[model samples]
Target: MAKGSNCSRWVLCSLVKLVFNDAYISTKIHHRQVSPLRRPPTAAIAGRARVPGFGTRVNRVCVRAVISEGDKKKTMVETSKELNESAVESGGWVDVRAVITIRKKMKENLNEKIEDQWEYVVNGMGQGICLQLISDQIDPVTKSGKSIESYVRGWMPKPLSHPHIVAYMANFKVPHDFGCPGAILITNFHGKEFYLTEIVVHGFKEGPIFFPANSWIHSRKDNPESRIIFKNKAYIPSQTPPGIKDLRREDLLSIRGNGKGERKMHDRIYDYAPYNDLGNPDKGEDLARPVLSGEEMPYPRRCRTGRPPTKSEPFSESRIEKPHPVYVPRDETFEEIKQNTFSAGRLKALLHNLIPSIASALSSSDISFKCFSEIDKLYNDGVVLKDEEQNIIDNQFLGNLMRRVLTAGQQLLKYEIPAIIKSDRFVWLRDNEFARQTLAGGQPKQELHLHRMSVEEAIENKRLFILDYHDMLLPFMERMNSLPGRKAYASRTVFVCTRTDYPYAADGLLIWSAIKELVESYVEHFYPEPGLVTSDLELQAWWNEVKNKGHYDKRNEPWWPKLDTKEDLCGILTTMIWIASGQHAAINFGQYPFGGYVPNRPTLMRKLIPHEDEPEYEKFIHNPQRFFLSSLPTQLQATKVMAVQDTLSTHSPDEEYLGQVHHLQSHCNSDHQVQIMFKKFSSKLEEIEKTINARNKDIRLRNRSGAGIPPYELLLPLSGPGVTGRGIPNSVSI
Candidate 1:
C-alpha cells in the first residue's frame, strides 16, 4: 500500500470512532477505490505514519464494517448525519460566544480611536513648552514697585546670564489663585545675570508681560548680579528698607516699595525742578526754606529798608526857591486894558448910534445926500453910466452896485438892527432922539398926489431896469431865493473870492436882493389890506400847483393864473410872503396869526395902531407941521419901532437892524417923498383922533356905548352913527 493511502485509511477510521461516540480507535478498513495523487507536495514531510503491517497483526479491534454496498452507503450517510448533529450541538454556544467576544473587542477598538483623536488638559492651552517671567512681589531701588529679582528667583528654571527683566505691578492686586499656571524665567544656567527678552504664557492665562533687560530693575549699580540670590529663607520682607541698590534684589526679598523716592531722584537727575537757586542768597530765598517747629514763625524780613532819604530833604541849602515875577512895560499893560475897554465901549456906542440911523435911512424914502454923492462918484469914475434917456445905461455896473448896496443894507437891517435895539442903552438913546425929533416936528402939507405918482413911476422904472440887468440879476436872484441856493452861492463865492479877489460886497448885494424880495412879499401879503386867502383847501391847492411847477421855469406857463379874484390875489400875496420870509417866519407870522383873522376881519384895516394913552402919538401930533416936512427923517423912527416890536415878538431879539434899513433903502426914489409923506399922514391922523376924543368926552360920559371909539371913525363920524342923531348910543340901543 502507498503511504498516502495508508494515512487516509487511518484518518477515516479515527473520524468514524470519534463521530459514533466511541473511545476505542477504529482499526478496520473498507475497501474503496483510491485515485493517485495528481502532484507531489512542495514542503518536506515531517511525521512518519505507521501502516498496519498490512494485516499481519490485525487485532480484534471493535471496528464496525458494513459489507453490503447499500448498507455501507446507509451507514456512511447515518454517520455523516450523526456527526453533523453532534457538531451542531457542540459548536452552537461557540457561535454565540464568538459574537459576544467580537462585540466586546469592537468596543475596545472604538475607545482606542477616540483616545487617539481628542485630549483634555487643566488650562485651555494645549500641552506645550513655554517660558514666563514671574512677577515680583517687591519694588526696586528707584521705588518702582514689583522688582524683577523676585520674579527670577521664584520662577526661573535656572539662574539668568543677561537678566533684562522689566517689573510690572498690576493695576489691581491679583489673588493667589488667579488661575495663572505660574511662569518660567529664560536664562543661562551658568550666567550670574539673566536678560529677559520675552515672556510667553504656557497655558490659558493672563499677565502683565515684562522684559528685564530694558527695565530699571536690570540697571542697578551696586547689585550687578543677573540672578536673584535669596538670603535667609525667611518670609521676604513685606516692606523693603530704604537704601536698596538693585531693584531685582529688592524684589527677590519680597519687599514692598513706592515710587515717591524714585520720582524725586528722576526729577533731580533731569534737573526738572520748576525753580532754580541762583548764587545770590537773596535770589534763592524764594526757593528753599528752613524747617520750623512748634511755635508759629513770622515771614522773613527784607534785607534792605525803605528808600534812602531824598537828596533835597537831606541837603537843605542846595537851591533857593524864588518867585519869578514877569515884567511888563507900562505901555503894553495900559494898551491891553485900553483895548479891552474899547471893545466893550465901541460895541455899545456902535449899536446905540448906528442902529437907529440905519433903521431911519432904510424906512425913509430919503437916502443920505452923502450916499447919493457916492453914487455920483461911481458914475464919474466910469463905475456907472446913464443912457441918453437919463436911465442907467451900463446894466452890469448898475446891477453890481445895486447888489452890493442891497446885500450890505439888508444884512445891516435884518441881523444888526434888532441886535442894536435889544440893548437898553441903544433903546434909550434911540427913543430920546426920536422924541426930540418929534417935538421939533408938526403936521405939514399933504404931498399925496405927487408922492403917489412918483412911487408908481419908480415901480415902472424898476421893472424895466430889472429887465435890462436880467442877466446879472437872474443869477443873484436865484442864489438869494432859497437856503440851498444861497449855500451853493456862498461856496462859489468862497472859491471865487479866493481866486479873483472879488470883494464880499458883491456877494452882500445878492443877499440884499433876496431879503428885499422877502420883505416886499410879506408887505404885499400880510401888511396890505385885501390880504391873502386863509382857506386851508385853497392854500393846499396853491401849494400843489407851485410844487408841480418845480423851480420857476420862465419858459413854461405860469402856475399862478392872473390874480382876478380877490381870493386868488390874496393867495398870490400869501405865497409871495412865504417865499420872502424863508418859510420859517411865514408859517408862524403870516399863516398862523394873520390867517386866523382872515375869515372875520377886513385885511387892509389891520394896521398896528397906538393905544389911547400912548405918548408916541401925542408926541408926534405936538409938532405935526414939522413931522410932515418933506425932508423930515421919520422913516428911521418908524423902522425903529418896527424893529423893536419884531425883536420883542420873535425869539431872535439880537438880529441886526441894518437888514431892515437896507430893505427900506431899496424902495427909495427921487420923485417920491415917502419919509415926509408918511410922517405927515401919521401926525394928521393922531391930531384928528385927539380932536374928536376931546370933543366927545361929554357925550361918552352920558352914553356908555361910545367909550373906546377908534380914530378912523373919528375922521368919518358924520358918515356913520356918531355925527347924526343915530349916534353910537342910539345905534347900540336899536
Candidate 2:
C-alpha cells in the first residue's frame, strides 16, 4: 500500500477507538455486561475475559471477525473499511444513510402486490379515495373483472356533486377489450357539485367511454395506458347506443345517503341537565358573567374544578353581603362593628355550608370541649418529639399538633361568637360517654377501643368526625397499632370537604398482595396472544424498532422502554397503583407542608403546552393551577367562641388589619371587602383562562399545519366488531 493510504487507515482506527471506547458510546458491544464468575482479566489481574491484546485503562478492542459478502471471514478493520466506503458511496453520514435505507425497505415491503383491475375514486382536489370492491365474471374482450355496482361497499369519502359528477360517471360503459383500466371520477368540481367535466382513466389495458353533454370526443379505447383527459360537451354521444342502458338515473338515487343533509337530534334515555358549562354556550357565559335583576344582586358562582367529585351541593354564598349584618357591641360603638364584621359574617355562613354529618358532630349536645393539656397522656413510650428528618412521630405528637392548630385557629377569630364555629381549624369536642370513657385514666387498649367505638358510632350515624390534621393522624394511628411506618400514610380518608377527603386506614401489605394476585391472574389469562410470540429475538427486534422511532433517548428520558421482564412489569404496576390510589398524595402531603415533590418517573397523564416557545415549558408548568387552588382557601368558616374573653384577649386585632377594615357609617354602606376579594380572585382566574386559551390556540394551529397530532386522536376503540371476547376471562379480580 502507498504511505498516504497506510497513514490514513491508522488515523481512522485511532479516531474510531477514541469515539467508540468512551462512556458516551451507547453501543452494547462496547460495554458488554459479563458475569461475576467471568470477570475481565484486565480488571486488576484476576481470571477474567478480555481482548487478547491492546488493552488500556481507558480503552479496549471491541471488534471481531465477521463473515463478509462471499461468506469469507473478514477482520474487523476490513469490514469497517468496506462499510465506511459503502456509506460514502451512498452519500451523507453513515447513520443517516442507514436510516434512509431501512425506510425505503419498509416502504417496498408495505406496497401492495395485486393483479386485479382496480379503480381509485379521485376527488376534485386530485386525491385518491379507496373503497372495498367485489369483482365478478371477467369480460372476454377487456379480460378484466367487473364488479356489481350495488356490491361496492363504502360510504362516500366526502360529499359529491349529485347533479353533475355522479350522473356523468354512471353514463360510462366499460371497455370491452383488454379490460377497462381504472378510472378517476372527479367530484366537487369548481368547489360546487361533482360535475362530470373531468374524468381521468389510468393504469388499464383498455379505457371506457363517457357520455355527458350531447357532443362526444372519441379516443383510442384499446390503449391501456393513456394520458388523462378533460372532455367538454363534445364527449357525449348524439343518441343512446342500442345495447347501452341508461344507468344515470339509478346512480343518482343510490348515492343519496352521503350525509350531505343535516342531522336530526335524538332524545336521550336519561334527562341530564346541561351541567358541563365549559362546553355549553348557555351556561358558559354565565360562568364569567353575573345575572342581575330587580331587588336581587348578581354574583359569579365559585368554580369547583379542584373540588372532590363526590360533593354534589354547590358551595353557599358569603353572607358578608347579607341584609342584616351581625352587630358587635363595643364601648367603641355600632358603626365600626358593621365594617369590621365582613370576614366574620362570611365565616359564619361557611359553617352552615358544612355537610350534615359534620354539623351534627360539632353541634352535638353531649360533646365536651377541652383545652389540650400534658396530663392527657399525649406521649409514646420511646418516641420523642424532634425536628429531625424521617423521624416517625407517635399518636401523642398528632394530638399535640392538632391542639396547636386548633389554638392557632381560635386566635384567628377575634369577633363575636357567631363566626366562632367557622374560624377554628379543629373542633376538639368528643361525646360525653367517649370522653369520659377514654380520659378516665384507663388502659391504652381500652382507650383505643373507646376511640374506635366513637368513630364507628359517628360513621353509623352518618356524622362526620373531621380530623383536621389527617396527614399526622393516620401515621400516628399506624405507629400506635405497631404497623409498618413507611406506608403509614397510605390509608384513605372517608370524610368529604370542599378541598379534601378524610382517609380510611389501610394495610399496605394486604393491598400490595391483592394487587399482585390480580396482576398475575390478568397476565396469565390475557397477556399471551396466539400470534404474539415474545421470544428474546422478537423482543430485541421490537426494541430496535422502538429505538428507530426516536423514542429511545438518554437514560430512557421522556420514553418508557417496553417491559422486557416480570420485575420491570411489577415495578410499573406498583407505581400505577400508588398513583391511582392517591397514596402518593397522602405520603407526600404528610412529609411536606404546603409543597411536595413528585418523582421524575413515567406518568399516565401527559400535559403539553404548544404556545410556549421553550422546550422546557411543559416541565415548568407542572400544573400550577392545582397548586394555587390548594394553597388558597375556597371558603372561610367561623367557629362560635368557646372561652370567649380569653380567646379575645389572646387574639386582639392587629393595627394593620384594623386599619384595612372599612367603617360602616350608614346602613347603605356595603361590605366592599367581599367585592374587592372577589374581584381579585376573578382577575387571577381570568389570567389562568387566558393562558389555557393561548395554549389551545397554539395546539389548533399545529394540528392545522400537520405539525402535530391532537392528543385526542391517539384514542382508538378498545373493543369492537371482530375483537373476540373468547379466551379472556369475563370477570378478572382487580
Candidate 3:
C-alpha cells in the first residue's frame, strides 16, 4: 500500500464510551496523584532501577516505557531505549496501559482474533518471544485504588528475554482512553533502535492495511511524535477555534495529540472536535491563521491606488465591534496570510476580487478565469487593438463583435499609470460590472444564456442563481474596505453560464456525489433514524458550536437549519464538504496557472477606462499594453501575490485527498461499517476520475476539450506532489 493510504486502525470510542469507560494513569510522587498539567520534574530525575514489576510499590526507574493494551486473545507491544545509565537512577515504571477483560459471551470469537493477532506478530515479526500476564485483581488503567498489574503475551520462535527497553517522554501527558485497549508491538531483542517506518492496522472492512508511520507516529527527530495509540483513545487535548473556519472558505487548522516530549504530534481537524479530535477548536486555535496587517511596501515602482470605485469601503464586517474571527496583525510584519487565504490572497483578493470557487466566477467579487481561459483569450483577441505605433483607437475597437460574445459595458476614461504605460486604452467592462459579475453565476438567477435571450425568459427558464452578496457587502464597501491599493465595489459577485462555466460545477458534482454518499452512509450508520438525529447530544452540540462560533455574526440568520431530521444533518454535512473539498479545489489549485497572467485576471484595477476627451485617452492612443498592465495590480503586488500563490497551490508530499482520508490513528480493533463505506467512496472517486478523463477527450464538450483550451482536469481527484493544479484534500488544512 502507498504511504498516504490507510491510517492506523484502532477505532475511537463514542461519547457514551467516553463518558463511562475512560482509562487514566497516575502515580504519587509527593504521595499524591500527579497533576496531568504539571511538567514532570527533571533536575533530579535522571536515573533508573533494575526492578521490574507492578502492583506492589512505586519502584523508580531511569528507562521510559512504550506501552500498549493486553487481552486474553489479542495483544500489541511497543518498546523504548535500553536503561539509561545517566537517567536510570530510580523511578517506577508506570503501567499506563489498559488491561481489557472479555466476558464468556464474547469469548467464542476471542480465540480467533487472538490467533490472528498471534500469527500477525509471530509470522510478520518472528520469534524468541516474551509475554506478560496479569488478572484484574486491580484495574491498571484507572486507579480507583492501587497497584495494577502490567503484562503482554505474544508468540515468538525462540525463548529469549527482550531486555533494557527505554521509554521517551514529551512535554505534556496523554489524554483519557475510552474502553478500547492500548496497542503496539515492542521488542529489545535486537540492539539497534527500531524506528516505526510503517504501521499495519487490521479489522477494517477493507481488511488489513499499512499506512505511513510518519503521518502519525513520527519517531524521527525532525518531527518527533511518538504517542501511544491508547493515549487518547477517548479524547485528545483540543481547543475551540475562534471563527477561523470561514477563512479560505474553511480553514480548520487544529491539533490531534496530547503526547508529551518526543511523542508530540501536530494534527488538523474539521469542526468542533474532541480535545483529541482534529476537526475543531479543541486544538485548532494553535494553528489559526494570523491576520496580515499593514501591507507589503509596494516595490521600487511608483505604487498607486485607484479611487474608491464605491464611496464606502470595509476594513471589516459591517455591524461588528470587531470581526468575529478578528484578525489582528502581528508586529509590523509584512507577510501575506498565505496559509488561510488560499484563493483570495493568491491574487490577494482582499485587494481585488476572486474568492475562488466560493464566489461565483461571474461576480465582480470573484474572478473565475482558470476554467475560462478560452474566453479570456477571445477577450484578448477581439478587444485589444493597436495601430502601427501600437496606439489604441476607439473606432478600431471590435465593439459590436465584442458585445455579441462578451459582457461589455459602458466606456469610462481617466484611470492611468505614469510609468511606461501611456493611456487607459484597455477598456474594462465597467458598464454593468454588476451584470458582468453576478449574472453569470448567481444562486437562483441561472441566467448565463445568449445575449439575445430576454432576462425574463431566462429567469422563467431557470437559467439564473444569486447568493445575494451584493446587498450584504454593499453597506460595508464604503465604510470598512477603503484601504489604499484596494478596489471595493458594492454589487460584486459570481455568475456562471452553465455552458461557459466550464467544469467547476459540472465536474465538481462528481466529487460532491461521492462525498454526499459517504456522508449519508455515515449518517445512516450513526443516526439510524430521525429521532436518533434529534436526540444526539454531541451532534447537536457540534452544530450549535459551528454556528455560534463559526458564523457567530450570522448565527441568528433564519436560514440556519434545525437538526430535527437526519436529512437536514446530511444536507449540512454535504454543503460543508463541498465548500472545503470540491469548491475549494476548483478555486484553489488553479491559482498561479490562472492568476500568473495578470492581464487575464487583474488583481486590482488601478486605472479605469479613460473617456475619449480625457488626456488619459490621448495617452491611451500612444501605447496600449503598458497602460493595460498598469491598470491591474502594481508590479510589486502582482509579484508578491504570485509568490504567495505558488506556495499555497503546491500540494505537499503528506497531502491527504478527498477520498483518501487516513492518518486517523485508531486505538482499538476497528468497526467495519464506516470503513467499508469509506472504501466505497474511494472507489467512486476513481470512477469520477475515469468520467472526467472521458469528458476531456470527447469533442462534444467544447469548453472542456476545445482548441486552445487546457483540458479542465483541475477537479480530477488525484495529483502528484507539487502544484499540478489538482487534488481535493479532505479539508482546508490551513
Give the Cα-based TM-score of candidate 2 against the true structure: 0.17
Sort by TM-score, top down from the best: 3, 2, 1
> Total backbone clashes of model 3?
105
Tens digits of per-residue lDDT for model 3 on 1-734? 00000001111122111111111110000000000111122221012112132222322211122333333113233221111211111243212322211111122267655653443353223221111111112234332111212222233222112111111221111112212122222222221112222233222222232222221222123222212222222211121111111110111111211223221112211111111111222234453322222232111110011111211222211221232322111111111222333433343323222112212322344232323232234224322222321221223476455334323321111111211111222222222222322222212233345466566655675655555657766767665445554554444343434454346667887788887787777667655656766554434554654554334345677988887787887787677667766878878877755454455355566555577988899766787655655556643454446556655677756455766642222322144565576668778999999999998898887656544445677799888766677777654444
Better lDDT candidate (2, 3): 3
Give the runs in model 1 whose Cα sits over 4 Å from its true position: 1-459, 462-580, 583-649, 652-734
Tens-digit lDDT track of model 1 for 1-734: 00011112222222211111111111211111111111222321112112221112222111111111223224334533442343211221210000000000112267553532221110012111112223333223334222111111111111122121111111112233323222222212211112222221211222122121111112122232222221111111122222221332322222111111222110101101111111122324343333221134222111111122224232111121245312111111112223343444334333333434533444434232123233223213312212321232224456566546544544333322222112222231332222211211111222233223354564554411111333435566544545421211111110001112111222223333433443344324322344333322223333333322221222144554553344554444334322322232212222211111111111111112234587656644675333223122232333333333232223221121111211111211111233333334334434443444454453432211122221111121112211111111101000
lDDT of candidate 2 at residue 136, scale 0 to 100:
25
RMSD of each: 64.2, 35.8, 18.6
TM-scores of the models, in the order given: 0.12, 0.17, 0.49
Error of 1 at 176 (Å): 73
Better of 1 and 3 by TM-score: 3
Give the RMSD in angstroms, all C-alphas superposed, for model 3. 18.6
Residue lDDT tens for model 2, 246-297 = 1211111221122122211110000101112222222343333222211233
- After superposition, which runs of candidate 2 have C-alpha atoms over 4 Å from their true positions? 1-515, 525-564, 570-734
